[model samples]
Every structure is written in C-alpha cells, then in structure tokens.
Target: MSLANVFSIAGSGMSAQSIRLNATSSNIANAETVSSSIDETYRARYPVFAHAMNDAQEEGSLFEDQPKAVGAGVQVMGVVESQEALQARYDPNHPMANEEGYVYYPNVNVVEQMADMISASRSFQTNVDVLNTAKSMMQKVLTLGQ
Candidate 1:
C-alpha cells in the first residue's frame, strides 16, 4: 500500500469513532428518560462498522500476479437500537406513570455507555496519532531529497 493510503485509512477510522462516540453519548443522555408507553421509550443505540477493502496490484511486481485485497478503511454500516427489554418501574405516584402505574425507562446502561465513550475517545485519539505519524514520515521523506 502507498503511504498516501495511510491518511485515508486513519481518516475513516476517526469518522467511525466519531459516530460511535455520538451514539454512546446519546445513549447516556437518554438513560434516565421515562416514557408512558413502551414504544416511546428510547433505546440504546450502537454503531455498526465494516472493514472496507480495495483490490490493488503490487506497485513494482514483475510477475503481474492477481491483485491483492487490502484493507482500505472502516465504514459505518449504520446505527442500530439495542433490542434488550426496557426497564419498567412501578412508580404509582410518578406523573409519567401509565394507567398500570408503570413507567418505561430506556434500556441504556450508564456504566456501559461510559465505557463505550471512553473506548471511542481513545480510538479517535489513536487515529489522530496515526495521521500525525504518517504526516511526519512523509515530511521526512521529502526532506531526504533536500
């Protein structure tokens, strides 16, 4: 793979991490939200990611063999809501309680969402480091000709 591909891969990783962070934050924000109806309760959201690959021929191979598939970057397939059952609390006096004196809470777990946030933040930072390293390498290569 060419050095230029490093930038593309790192950028895609950053983008994917950003989406993950967003979803985690959203889940955390709605963790305590209550709904009178089960259908209206917010569900924890997670982002789906897939590896993007490209078929590239070797730059200077003499045999002209078949192209090899290489990892280009990560792509966000989509965000999906968790299917886990929502939290049903029996709070007869609560204003949002339904006729059955039950209020539906989001399925989001605060601790889990916090962990996901930390992971996504670290992944994003790692991608930033990769880009910086690639940039430094490219600069050094240019200086070699000076």
Candidate 2:
C-alpha cells in the first residue's frame, strides 16, 4: 500500500483498539456493582469489530499504484452486552438485599475482565507501534527522495 494508505490503516486500527480498551475498562469498573434485581445489575459490555473495505483503492487503475492495495482499516461493528445471568448472593445484612435476603450482582467476572483489559491494552499498544513504524518508514522514504 502507499505511504498515505499506511497512515490511514494504522489510524483506523488505533481508533478501534481505543474503543475496545474503553469498553473493557468500563466493564471492569462496574464488575462489582450490586443491585436489588437482575434487571438493575450491569451487564458486561464488549466492543465488536469488522474489517472495513473501501472501493476507491481498487487495483488496476490507470496510474501506477502500490502492489498491495487496501483502502482502509478495521471498523467497529458495535458494543454488545453479554447475556450471562446475573450473580446472586445470599446476604441478609446487605443493604440492597431483596426480601429473601439475596442481592443481585453484575455478571462480570473480575478475572475475565482483567484479562480482557490486558488484551485490549496490548492490542492498542500494538496499533500505536504500527502507526509509529509506518510513520518512521514514510519519513525515511521522504528523505530518500530529498
């Protein structure tokens, strides 16, 4: 792909990873939240992603083009809520306990959320590194022409 396209691809990747990291952090922060009923409990949130394609960069154009051509980067599909069941705990002294002395907690698993957070953070960092590398390569190419 062209040097300009490299920047676009890496920029989209970084944006998608940022959304993923934000969702993971949000899920972790609300993992321990308690509620009186299942409906009131927070559900784990996850960001979905899909590959984005742009037709404008199709090959076989009249002008010379990069051997490898990709129009854009990934796109975030959406944030989805997990359908896991809410956690229930028996605690008579709990302030939010129901009539049966049971409190409902979010379905979030701390261990899983922490792992997801780490993964997302790492992915984001990787994207940043890709952007940096692409930038440096582009700079070097520019210097070669000078």
Candidate 3:
C-alpha cells in the first residue's frame, strides 16, 4: 500500500479502537450497577468490527485475488450485549431488591473489562505510531531529490 493509504488505514484503525474503548468504558461504568429486575440491569456491551474489504468479488464467489481484496481498514459493525446470566445478590435490605429479596447486578467482569481496555489502548497507540511512521516516510520521500 502507498504511504497515503497507510494514513487512511491507520486512521480507520484508530477510529475502530476508539469505539472499542468507549464500549469498554461503558461496561466498566455500569459494572456495579444493581437492578431490581433482569430487564433493568445493564448488560456488558461490546463493539463488533468488520474488515473494510472492497465489494468487488471473484467470479462465482466472494473470494477475490489478494490485491483486489485488500482491506480498506475496519468499521464498527455494532454493539452487542453479553448474554451471560446476571449475578443475583441476596441483599434483602438493599433498596433495589426484588420481591424475592434479591438484587440483580450486571454480568460485567471487571478484570475482563480492564483487559479489554488495555488491549484497546495498545491498539490505538499502535495506530498512532503507524501514522507517525508513515508521515516520516513521506517526508523522506520528498527529500529524495535533495
């Protein structure tokens, strides 16, 4: 890919990582939230990404030659809620306790969320490095005649 395309690809990666960070942050924020009912509890949400591949397809199949199938970058497909069962706490005195003297907490795993945050942060940093390196490369290219 061209140095110019590097900028576009890195930018897209940065954007996708930003979305992932946001999702992780949201999940962390609601990790401890308690609810009286399952419907009211906050479910951990995650962002989905899809390869930004070109629409052109090979004859009779979605597959294409490597060069033609070069990914543009990535895009956030959507956010999906975790389907894991919620935690039920037997806190009879809690204000949000249900009729059965149980309060429902989100299924968010704090440790997992922390790991996700770290991964997203590193991915973002990597993309930033990519852009910076691309910029330096482009600058050097301009100096080839000097």
Candidate 4:
C-alpha cells in the first residue's frame, strides 16, 4: 500500500480508539450511579469494531491496471451495552431505593474500565505515532532526489 493509504488506515484506527475511550469513560463515570429500577440504571457500553476493506478492490476489474485489493481501515460497528447482570444492593436509607429497600447499580467494573481506558489511550498514541512515522517517511522520500 502507498504512504497515502497509511494515513487513512491510521486515521480510522485513531477514530475507533477515541470511541473506545469515550465508552470506557462513560462506563467509569456511571459505575457507582444508583437507580431505583434496573431499566433506569446505566449499563456499561463497549464499542464494536470491524475491519474495513476497500469496496472497489473487492469488485473484479476488467483490466489489470486496477490496484490490488487492500484494507481500508478499522470501522466502528456500533456501541453496545453490556449484558452482564446489574448489581442489586439493599439500602433502605437510599433515596433511590425501591419498595423492597433495594437499589440497582450498574455492573460496570471500575478496575476493568480503568484497564480498558489505558489500552485505548495506548492504542490512540500508537496510531498517532504511525501517522507521524508515515509523514516522516514521505518527507524522506521527497528529499531522496537531492
């Protein structure tokens, strides 16, 4: 793939990682939130990602002049709420407690969310590094003629 394609790939990766970070932060923020009902409680969210391919490359061309099939980039499928069971606590004094003196809390694991945040941050930084390295390589290529 050309250096130009590297930019597109890295940019898409960065976007995906950004979404991941957002979801992790949101999950962490709502980790301790209490709700009276399960339906009202916030659920941990995770971003779904899939590999994207060049659509044009998938179609067979009549001539051989067409570029070979290449990966487009990472695609964010969507954000999905975790299906894990919510935490139920018995707290009669809580304002949000239900009639049974129970309060519903999200199943978000703060430790897990913290780890995910770090991973997303590192991935984002790696993508940025990829972009910078690609830019530097392109610049070096231009200077090769001198």
Candidate 5:
C-alpha cells in the first residue's frame, strides 16, 4: 500500500472517533435528566461502527488486485439507544413525580457514561496520533525524492 493511503485510513479513523466522542458526550449530558414518564426520559445512545473494506473488488474491476484499491477504513453505522429499563424514583414532593408518587429517571449510569467518555476521548487521541504518524512518514517519503 502507498504511504498516501495511510492518511486516508487514519483520517477515516479520526472521523469515526469524533462521532463516538460526540455520542458519548450526548449520553453524559442527558444522564441526569428526569421525566414524569418513561417515554420522556432520555435513553443512552451509542454509535455503531463497521469496517469499510475496499469495495473495488466487489465492483469487479480489472484493477482489483492492486493494493491501491484495497484501502480499508472505519465507518459509523448508526447510533442506537440502550434498552435498559428506566430508573423509578420515589419522590412524593418532586414536581415530576407521577400520580403514584414516583418519578422516572433515565437508566443512564453516570459512572459508565464517564468511563465511555474517557474511552472515546482516548480513541480520538489515538486516531490523531495515527494521522500524525502517517504525516511524518509521508514527509519522510517526500524527502527521499528530494
């Protein structure tokens, strides 16, 4: 594979990580939200990713065997909500309390959300590092031509 392809791969990784970080941030932001009903509570969201394999081969092109066309990257499939049950809090005096004197809270676990945030942040940093490394390697390659 050409050194140029490294940039493309790393760039895709960075983009995917950015999306993950955004979703994690959104989940954390809504973690403490309360609702009078389960339908109103915010559920935790997570980004799904898939491997973006080179599709040139599937396209059945004559140049399929070339490594230039084999570059793989990461793809964000979609965001999915957690299916965990909502937390039921007994708060007779709470404004959002239901007729049964119970308020519904999001099932978002604060600790887990924080951990996911950290992991996503770290993954983003790692992708940035990958891009930086690819850039340095590309620069070195250019120097060889000079």
Candidate 6:
C-alpha cells in the first residue's frame, strides 16, 4: 500500500478504538443502574467493527486497470447489547424494586469494562504512533530529493 494509505488506515483504527472506548465507558456508567422490570434493565454494550475495502481496489476490478485490493480501514458494524442475564437483587425497600421485591441491575462487569477501556486506549495510542511514524518517513523521503 502507498504511504498515503497508511494514514487513512491508522486514522480508521483510531476512530474504531474511540468508539470502543465510548461503549466501554457507557457500560461502566450504567453498571449500577437499577430497573424494576427486566425489559427496562440496561445491558452491557460493545462496539462491533468490520474490515472495509475500497471499491476500486477489488482484484477483479469493476473499473478497468485498477490495482490490487487494498484495505481501506475499519468500520463500526454496530453496538451490541450483551445477552447475559441481569442481576436480580432482592431489595424490598428500594423504590425501584418490583412486586417480588427484586431489583434488576445491568450485567455490566466494571472490571472487564475498565480492562477494555485500557485496551482501547492503548490501541488508539498505537494508531497515533503509526500515523506519526508514517509522517516522519514521508518527510525523510521528501528530504532525499534535496
């Protein structure tokens, strides 16, 4: 791939990591929220990402004389809610408690969400590093002609 493509790829990666971080933060924030009904209970949310390829870069090009397939970047598929069972805590005196004196809490695991946040943060930093390195290399290449 060309040096220009490197920047686009790294930028996409950073965007994806940012989305992941947002989802992790949202899950963490709602971890302790309680609901009276199962339907109203918050579930852990996570971001899904998919590989994106440029249309013109297809092997059997739709357009004539096109180059080989090149990865464009990553795209966020969507946010997925965890299917894990919600916590049913018996709190008879709680305002949000159900008729059975049970309160529903989100399935979010704070520790896991924090770990995911750290991972996303590191991934974003790595992408930033990649962009910086690419920019430095490109600058050096320009100096070669001088």
Q: Order of candidates by lDDT, top first?
A: 1, 4, 6, 3, 2, 5
Stretches of candidate 1 exceeding 4 Å from the true structure: 59-66
Top-lDDT structure, candidate number = 1
Off by over 4 Å in 6: 55-68
Which portions of model 5 show Cα errors greater than 4 Å?
56-71
Q: Write the per-residue lDDT of candidate 4 for residues 13-104, one digit (tens) a residue.
A: 99999999999999999999999999999999999999998745344667767656568899999999999999999999999999999999
Candidate 6 lDDT, 95-122, residue by residue in tens = 9999999999999999999999999999
In terms of TM-score, which candidate is strongest?
Answer: 1
User: Which scores better on TM-score, 2 or 6?
Assistant: 6
State which candidate, 1 or 2, has the greater TM-score: 1
List per-prediction Cα lDDT, in the order shown.
Answer: 0.94, 0.83, 0.90, 0.93, 0.82, 0.92
Q: Write the per-residue lDDT of candidate 2 for residues 1-146, one digit (tens) a residue.
A: 56778777888888988898888889889988898888888999988988887655445746765454445798999999999888899998999999999998888888997888788788878878888898898789889967
lDDT of 1 by residue, 2-106 (tens): 899999999999999999998998898888999999999999999999999998756646785666789999999999999999999999999999999999999
TM-score of each: 0.94, 0.86, 0.90, 0.90, 0.85, 0.90
C-alpha positional error of residue 51 in candidate 2 after TM-score superposition, expressed in Å: 0.7
* Tens-place lDDT digits, model 3, residues 1-146: 45687888899999999999999999999999999999999999999999897643434435744435667899989999999999999999999998999999999999999999999999999999999998998899999999
**Model 5 per-residue lDDT tens digits across residues 98-119:** 8999888887888987888788
Model 2 residue runs over 4 Å out of place are 56-71
* Model 1 RMSD, rounded to 1 decimal: 2.1
